[model samples]
Target: MTSEAAQYWENRYRERGRTWSGRVNAALEREVNGVAPGSALDLGCGEGGDALWLAHNGWSVTAVDIAPSAIAIGAAAQQPGDDIEWVVADLAEWQPPRRYDLVTASFLHSYVELPREEILRRAATAVASDGLLLIVGHAGVPHWAAHTPHEGEVVELPSPDEMLEALRLEPAEWTVLTKALVERPVTAPDGSAGTIDDSVLMLRRNPAVS
Candidate 1:
């Protein structure tokens, strides 16, 4: 089943000609720029835009996605200075070989079920002490009246409280540096111009207790 999903995403990227904007997320750029350079992981890194940006900014990046075609496109777009390791694997099953100073999961939340909490927990575990975890996704339904009747799968965008509860990270170990809704111009699937509300969480991991 996982293989099939990966194939599906790969086919979609192949057919559509593009899956991402080929640039880093605007919110991420602002937040990550000030942090010290360290090992970084880009989860669900479609087309590796974010990973490439991280590499250019002095981070050693590991980019992972379920779509093989996305990974291929990302690799092809890699520049000479971009040091990124692109991996084709599902996050539900794949585990990192080592911890990182920064972990980023962006815009991939809508694809999972109840297992998301566990996945996020694992993401937190992969962060080293004094590291950071950044999770950004759509805040809610694109619009109240926007409807895709045939697409039976309903995407539930997690609220700030829900995300905090799901991760279950201890307060003393980490802090929610930022959690807010941001409105940005977006093109909807129907080719209509609209806006998207993105929910962003930036958590800073505290140094481990001696």
Candidate 2:
């Protein structure tokens, strides 16, 4: 991440004072609950909710984010004996030292210019053989999003199939475990409850092929 990009996120995090809910993401919780515990890497780990949850569930986790303040907050929240490593780095330029059993990027959309597709492709390569790569992105705005800042924005979100194409994983080598738009309830900007579609893509690499 450039200094300017880091600064922007730092300021945003400071201003928001907990931009996201501390609870684990519903999609992640549901998906991981059925899988075996293993090493996991969480990209764009805002406040470490998913990282902490993975640790508690017996997985060794490496949580990363571009903002130092956000990483600091997550580090401070760490408990003793928790198997987690907090890292502050730009996911766009980061190279994983080793492959992980699970690589996840949850709602990694950024207002700033970023090589989002390339970053996600790199994340896919970091998944160990027979391991999982899970990417979650917004399918569209909820019905109650009229009052939000995103109301007028032209958000071009890709589908799970598009993500699979970006990953460039061979059909014979990777199994698409889940590819669909799942609905998740959320509190709208106006305090009204609404549902949003979560574009979920989960693929498992074939050990034999890898």
Candidate 3:
């Protein structure tokens, strides 16, 4: 665990009641709904929105985050007998206990220094054979974010191709399902609104791989 990064997220959630919308991410819902329910791993699951949704959809889910407070909040909202496990751990060092049919990392970016690619590669490894790995990242900072303190700063996030390259999966061993930039309207932290680009990358590990 990166102690500094963990502390930063904890403080951010503490100062702000919630850092993100409690609802599941749009891309996650769209991608997951078409598939059959199975074991899932939600990496960097802030407040367990995706995990809760998956559990409700009949998926046995394991959700992890760096902030214990966030996990506590999510745990409190879990319904009785829901097959969701909320875990507080730093993704920088933590490893998934078992492979899963679906592994998702939605907007897992952080201002704190961490090896993003390395963590994502670990996520890919946690996907079971013939399973799916979905990674969603901000293609660029939203125009509304320009009004914030980061004004005039160019925030460059990884492109879908760049992320695919970082994963270094063999073409014969994995199938690239989707790689595109999706635009969506959003309300920023200060209530400013604008369209944001999301870099979506979804891959499936071939069951034939030894």
Candidate 4:
């Protein structure tokens, strides 16, 4: 069943060419840039845009997604000198082979009722001491509200505080550097444009010894 969803995403990417606009997620690029180079894992890395960016920026990345087609596309698109390992696996079942300096999950908004705490726990566990875990996703309803009218299927979002509490990080372990609801314009599949309000949260892991 989960494999089917991955295939669906792969097909979607194939049909859409590239769903992402070839730009790294704004919050991650800004907050995670200064961290020292180390192993990085990109969960739900669609089309490898962000993974490619990280590889170019000095991080050796293991980019994972549920879709094999997406992984293939990303592998083919990878440029010379950009080092990235693409894996096809569901995040719930996938485990990192080693700890990392940075762990990121961006725009992963599916499974609203899913146990995000467990996911965050795994992410936190995968991080080395002094490492960073960066989770960025759409804060509120998705931009394509008209297309997805179903209640639980679409627009299911989590508050920043909810995520922070779920992760169980003490105030001393991490700090919320940015948390805000931001409105941004979005273009629809029909070429129509609209606005979406997204909640953004950026957390920085404290390097100080616990």
Candidate 5:
């Protein structure tokens, strides 16, 4: 992405005191609850909710986002002993330095021009052998967004099947743990309670693949 992308997000964060709920994503929290903690990577880690949750749950976390203000808010909220490495970098140009046992890209959507498919493919590749990859995203335009006009563009989100196909993982190398659309409750912009579909894909790399 260009500087416009970064500027757009930076302004969003700066304009709003806190844009997101300071809690781990619902899907991620449920899926990873019983798993053993390990090194984790959080792509597009705005405000670092998921990353902070992982760190508190014993997972070493690397949280990366394009907005420095968002990263700073999350960093400032950190408790002592939280093992989190916060990075401010655009996911379009950012590369993971090492493999991670668990990788998460929750709501990696953007209003600006974004290479969504390519970024997701790279995220899948960063998983180590026997590692897990989890992606959660809006399945379609939310009712609120559809009813109301919004600034910037509303990027169309892909279905779970489309996301899996885009990743192009070798059949023999990955196990599909989850591929489904789940409804999550949320408060709309007008403060009305509602639900939205979230395309969820969770995969585990087969162990000992050479």
Candidate 6:
């Protein structure tokens, strides 16, 4: 599915003038604000919105995404002093060469077959000791979508608890910081107001005991 997935997003980005809002995701900004800034990894970073925001907030960031065009859009937006390194690779197979202080996956949902659970488990391994793993996912169909991202596909949205189970986190080594369903407001293409439900899971990897 790698080629198919890459092509799907590449076409989507090329077809649209700007596929995503350049602004940082609201949930990410709200959740991590005022925390000590450090190295951050943004998985499936579409156009580097969150990575840019992290850079602005004094974090060295590594942002990865599958589509070259999508990341090219992000690379074009970089400024003179942004401490961000962008990578083009499928998250399903990409491995973090080093650990980070904060690893985030915002709206990592895809229209293609992605081993999301396995990918996320590997993502956790990229978190440094005492670092954070923040995942934000669509909890249900968007209020404005005529169909899901995969048109007419009956994808099941997992509950927060269900997702936690899938991550297969070792409780002795991880602490669940936040688990909740959050509502995000949105504007439909027709300028109508709507809301989307999102699942938020924030985990902190415990420091090694002496």
- Whole-model lDDT per candidate: 0.83, 0.86, 0.87, 0.75, 0.92, 0.89
**TM-score of candidate 2 to 2 decimals:** 0.92
User: Global CA lDDT of candidate 3, please?
Assistant: 0.87
| Candidate 4: tens digits of C-alpha lDDT, residues 164-192 | 67777677777677776667677777888
Candidates' RMSD to native:
2.5, 2.3, 2.6, 2.9, 1.9, 1.8
Highest-scoring model, lDDT: 5
Clashes of each: 0, 0, 0, 1, 0, 0
Q: In model 1, where do residues sit more than 4 Å from their true spots?
A: 111-114, 141-152, 187-193
Comparing 2 with 5 on TM-score, the higher-scoring candidate is 5
- Give residue 94's error in model 5 in angstroms: 0.8
Per-residue CA lDDT of candidate 5, range 136-203, in tens? 99887656665543776777688999999999889899999999999988887888887889999999
Could you give candidate 1's per-residue lDDT for residues 133-207 as a string of tens digits?
998877866653556645646566887677777898889999888888878877666778877778788898898
At residue 68, what lDDT does model 3 achieve?
A: 86
Q: What is the lDDT, from 0 to 100, of the residue 61 in candidate 5?
A: 96
Candidate 2 off by > 4 Å: 147-154
* Model 3 TM-score, all chains together: 0.91
User: Which residue pairs of candidate 2 clash?
Assistant: none
Itemize residue pairs with steric clashes in candidate 5.
none
TM for every model, in the order presented, reads: 0.89, 0.92, 0.91, 0.82, 0.94, 0.94
Cα distance off (Å), candidate 6, residue 129: 0.6
**For residue 206, what is the lDDT in candidate 5?**
95
When 3 and 6 are scored with lDDT, the better candidate is: 6
